[model samples]
Target: MIVDAWFTVQQIDEATYAISEYGHWEKVHSFLLLGTKKAALIDTGLGIDSIKRITNQLTDLPITVLTTHVHSDHIGSHGEFDSLCVHEAEEDWLISGIKGLSIDIIRKNIGRDITLPTPASFNPETFTPFQGKPTGLLKDGGEIELGERTLTIIHTPGHSPGHICLFDKSTGYLFTGDLLYDETPVYAFYPTTNPADLVASWERISSLKGIYKIYGSHNTLGLEPSLLNEVKIAVRYLRENDLAKFGTGIHRFSGFSVQF
Candidate 1:
């Protein structure tokens, strides 16, 4: 069975927020401090009507939305925000605003008559299509200073060539995009995910200690200290182990060829 449109928000800390995707759950998004003069949206949901409706209902605090990557689902909706930032490697997709990859996959999975309000899907007059101008170019070591808060830009490419994560050094909070997600990492059938790099990226992410609250692009951060360890174990396991040994669910996303 398929799922319908829906949105969810979770409070990460005093001011941080997490936004989720509409259907067939994966990749949890994080929004930081809507009330703090300048709030930062870590990742945008699929640019579907469900996400758009909920985004409008949320606090309108001169938001500065920045995507962790340019996967169809994470960035398609971001076109609505006037100004946002993204990793340099994915800046082209953000500017190009191409569709076809994840959009069709999600729609098919949902089995619903849904249409995203993007330039390709809808006209500007009908609804505001997200055509954001990128103001910041995120580098591997660059840091984003929003008001008093800061999110370090760590380039952990794997899921995509320029995938990034936001680390709040002050709070020791890590907001990983698709590069480090809770779901059994999906490999690229259409040339999006790079399996070899994804497994290695986990090693890089695990190096950071005292990471109190960790998050993915799909679900609320469960303070899963187990996640950190699990990631490390998963990495080494994939390096030597045959992915085919796992159940079909693990390989169903992209075949058993690539390990994550």
Candidate 2:
């Protein structure tokens, strides 16, 4: 029987691809970090109902979902996973709901105002229904075993202090959340966004060796190996706006290098 998978494995390695509910916001591509027996889903998309449509296509294998940060688009379906993992720093944000300003940014990015209904368990007075919950807290170097494989949680703060990247050192695959993207990274964000820390994250990531390929939480799966280098393009854009702010040269992520 043919089961249409929500994620397609990258032809080159232990990587899987899926699109976020927000298709036009280009940086919204999510990924599956697969080991031999189990897989880790990185970043859920903007809309929970849409997440069900995408996840319904996934394998019956037990899956654990994690978010790079608590932004609404990245953690919309947090409750779907048996256990949801997020950086400790974002725990409050997840429980309280994402920043009000980011939603407006998303609306502008998507070119429309999409108001999602709250989940039944939520109280409209203090809580939002559509916003999901985080079940576990993760930190840098934290490891999770999915069957025979182990994925390392690299805390690459900046985009958000708790922002994380999943690295499969064995396969050289890094699931970079918004901290590194193929588009203009938005440094001017609400709640918490430190361009300096983000630049440091680039330096930290550049040290990884044997990184066969890189994936983004947003729209960047089709990035041919060659195009993956465009993270520098993002850094350059950020630099033009304020080079001195980052404390050093821009750090970019192409498939081969994270330029700083």
Candidate 3:
């Protein structure tokens, strides 16, 4: 394994790697999935450092950055990649900046709660989230073929209008993005989020068959597929009690929790 001052690289398989920033409070994780002809990078980490440095060491194939969402933390290093693809719902936000989200809040969130030394280039005061056009737009059910491997895009919105989850059909690996994760509450209480849609998304992913493992963008590196069962129960509970709305506080399930 390659050692770095930042970014912990873990091998999930010979063709897949999890690039994580455990030092950051969010514990953001970016994935590198290698195919025979190309590679797919799922969301860059916080712009505390250049994630391209790690990707370069992982593969020589052309990298296609598949953004799970346009959140500041997820797209921090988006500018470092040339071929970027985001959901059609977030295409405008990608070209422009996420509306109503203040740079001050972003800077504050990115700068604080750090346990590791950040790169000198990272200046939260002046730190700007990557904003530009995407090479293409992806939609729900859209399939991306990286040589022999195929990633199916799931439009699991609610956390954000354009938030998505990627499913690796061949490996049965589901990259849930921010839509699902353990530890901290999955956020849907923000003005931009829709709690109802979030529950629906949880139901959608929970119903997905043959998921071997779940890879969320933050906190834990991987979750067992059995957690999907818990998600199903949580979704039913949230919808049954009519609690899938903002200001509902935190709803804890057996394996995960959500705030709406």
Per-candidate local distance difference test: 0.62, 0.61, 0.94
TM-score of model 1 (CA atoms): 0.74
Model 1 over residues 27-69: C-alpha lDDT tens digits?
4455554545677777677554344455555666677777888
Better of 1 and 2 by TM-score: 1
Residue pairs that clash (backbone atoms under 3 angstroms), model 1:
27-217, 27-218, 28-217, 28-218, 28-219, 79-130, 79-131, 80-130
| Candidate 3 colliding pairs | none
Runs of candidate 3 exceeding 4 Å displacement: none
Residue 69 in model 1: shift from native, Å? 0.9
What TM-score fits each model? 0.74, 0.72, 0.99
For candidate 1, give the lDDT of residue 138: 88
Which candidate comes out best when scored by lDDT?
Answer: 3
Write the number of the candidate with greater lDDT, choosing between 1 and 3: 3
Off by over 4 Å in 1: 1-6, 22-30, 34-36, 50-60, 97-133, 188-190, 220-223, 241-260
Q: TM-score for model 2?
A: 0.72
